[model samples]
Target chain A: MLSPKRTKYRKAHKGRIHGLSTSGTTLNFGQFGLNALQPERITARQIEAARRAITRHMKRQGRLWIRIFPDVPVSVKAAETRMGSGKGSPEFWVARVHPGRIIFEIDGVSDTIAHEAFALAAAKLPINVKVVARQGEGA
Target chain B: MANAIKLAATARDRAGKGVARETRRQGRIPCVIYGAGQAPVMISVDAAAVARDVHASNFVTKTYDIDVGGVSHHVLPRDVQFHPVSDRAIHIDFLRIDAASLINVSVPFEFKNAETSPGLKRGGALNIVHHEIEVRCRPDQIPAHITIDLAGLEINASVHLSGVSFPEGVVPHVSEKDFTIATIATPSALRGKEDGEGDGAASPAEAAKA
Candidate 1:
């Protein structure tokens, strides 16, 4: 659902996602968040689902900040067609979930509530994640 | 020391998420400058200029003369908010300062005379502990980067904050403790190799005895 209005070029280079990730290591916005342990392409639908889970758990009381945004365009080919011609049509937009990147952050709620809400949100994602709290919040 | 740069800006009065978003849409960076016994002044500057300045080495230390609608304001960048996906600078906060302002700023380190160090010549690695030292100084008196002379350092030798020269009128904020800046250490890989050789020599004699 979230795609860039314009791009320099249609397709991007296959970037190397391997090696240790360096960004998104620190908690920035919210009190609690989910840190990506493995690289993934998180879809907009998955993010929406995660958002719904958090909103449902919090009962619209606290703020939920989605750290990642679905901006990278992922193209797709027809399933039953031949594997020739040009690159496939733009299928969906995805947020590249590199390791150490915060996926979601929530604040203004109790620790127990934040934990359960993040747990529910984490289930919708595909990559390995660890729930992290704001430094000095608990320990 | 890095030269102080000038940035063009427009003064804004309103403050909110919608306002910030609108500023971004107009290709500008929304910012607020407060402190120094004055009320907060909201403004916006060219996003590209802020991005370029943010990438400079002295981004956190250098003084910026932001020209907002013909009025000039000397300030230091306090924070920069980037777009989540694009990693572009969207918003920023600049703290207003003056010649009389003795604000605390972190000045990063610049290792000097590394080639002259005997320990470094023998494959010793410099382990930096404090990347920067917070100092209370005027905006014009802020040092771009503090240099640590490693000429006299040997392996296992530590350089404390007192060893580096502080700029005139720039006093370190930490008067309580003499913190270490960096240390010359033996490389772990070399140490491991030397330890393996010592163990191998001892094992041969022990094996012969057995």
Candidate 2:
């Protein structure tokens, strides 16, 4: 007796092994919580660190990075725009990571040293760092 | 001797979108001044004066003396909203700067020695990934423009973020070292594929078929 020829192999196995995704559109990573430092609580040291981190990262990476430090007691209007009354700004400080970019979203922490540490850490990233911010309604 | 334009403006009494629309109908641009730890003050700027500045690529970081309500504010461009279809600046935002406050702004990048660079002479092309970089410094310490020197770069040579130098008090926002800003690369062969013209000389089989 002759065996039945296998005609449906490609169709049955193709495009299914990848599991749960549809083609054509990009993948969605979803959102995460973000924090902003209180202006009055931020220290000079944090601001200095932020500056240093930005400088150092720029040196190690071949891309330009921007340190976005919000002015303390930022105007209500400015805050509305910067933080966006809707969901707040997704990024406060941004840096270059090869083939992509990295941003830091820190709320209530816009200080000299905090910014410095953030930058210093960003410079050491071995892989892509995409810092996104998602702020919920306040308590 | 210099192209100095005197413009007039009005202080916005009611601050909101409705007021802004009325201002625009009168051929004016709504703007605000903030910084120096003071509340943001809403003002109107001459629509024409703002349109002129918007034409420049480095308008945002560039300093300007804006007179509003009989008071002049030392400010820099902050943000601008543009018309979606026309892409013309419809609204503008200005940030007041105290000479002493450290400010972060992006400076225009200017390439120098490009014509004589080895990369270009050797058939390699220069690709500028970025046209500008943001910097932080005092108002007086702000740089007018940033310079990128492409001297003897060879094919595949890249200039990174760390390679750039900043004027005193002006520093890049990134903390990484050796981040790339621009690169010299061999031009893509696919560029001419659509037109079927290039140095990729037709294959023997293709030549024979032709």
Candidate 3:
């Protein structure tokens, strides 16, 4: 799973995602992209799972880019623990994704392969996604 | 010069978010034609017609003859705003142009002879640095697209702006440096093989395991 090596604070506050993403909305590096259709907090494990699915479907033939990173540390309280003991230790990392963000990009693959790869990857994600090709390129 | 595509549109009296939304609800795309010292004209074109054109190749470079309420306007597509989620055309901006007008337009590159490139044959990736190059030319002289030949390129070889040939009277907008347009880059799998043989440093995965 992807996580930060170090951080300024051990635990961070959970933030809210609002509105559509203003950046990372366009396909900058690849010919095909998987676009987010709703806002959600995606865990590092989920990201890794999606990446594995995409790479496995592509047979590692084309290049892939994960546009979003799991930077937010999510902490949890232990089971059956009655009261608050300050804050629970950081358990995992998550990425707050906004609507219209391009979560994954792929290149050097045929349109059919790219679409299939994205479809396999989308099953691992929590939000709805659509496969998009770069404008003026293959549809 | 390529023949201008003809599109019919209706003039609209109002312009705003509400009006634009209303226009979209009626299956029309809100558009504006401005430039050449003339007042801007607010119009609405058929949603399907404009969407087809926008999705086509070299949309901005294509010239259009827009007939607004029986008045003809020669224009070039300047910008398109798409709905974030639906990816629908929400708004469009068109620039009025004429024969004498010299405009700077971004022309896409059409790479040719990729199969003949020695670099591509060796499992190298054609990493495009610039998909399009901005050029200054008369509206009528704007080439549909610039061609970049990749016939004899080898791994790590680069094609720069200086090496490209443009049509008569069309010149690259940037005159400062010979910027790279594309390169035959080594694939990551090939890079890994070279690195393992050349260096003793532990890979990221190996380091993580440790």
Question: What's the lDDT for candidate 1?
Answer: 0.73
Identify the runs in model 2 with alpha carbons over 4 angstroms from their true place.
A1-139, B1-7, B190-210
Predicted complexes: DockQ each: 0.02, 0.01, 0.37
Ranking by lDDT: 3, 1, 2
Residue B51 of model 2, lDDT score = 70
Query: Model 1, B129-168: lDDT tens per residue?
Result: 6666788888888887777899978888999976778878
TM for every model, in the order presented, reads 0.56, 0.52, 0.90
Assess the local accuracy of residue B91 in candidate 3 as a C-alpha lDDT between 0 and 100. Answer: 91
lDDT (Cα, 0-100) at B92 in candidate 3: 91
**For candidate 2, what is the DockQ-based docking class?**
incorrect
Which candidate has the top score in DockQ? 3
Best by TM-score: 3
TM-score for chain B of all predictions: 0.81, 0.80, 0.91
Q: What count of clashes does model 3 give?
A: 0
> Among all windows of ten consecutive residues in candidate 1 chain A, which has the lowest summed lDDT?
A130-139
Candidate 3 local lDDT, B1-210, one digit each (tens)? 588889999999998889988999999999999999999999999998877778655888989999998899999999988777888888999999998979998888999999999998887778888888889999999988899999999989999988999999999998659999988877666665654432222223334765
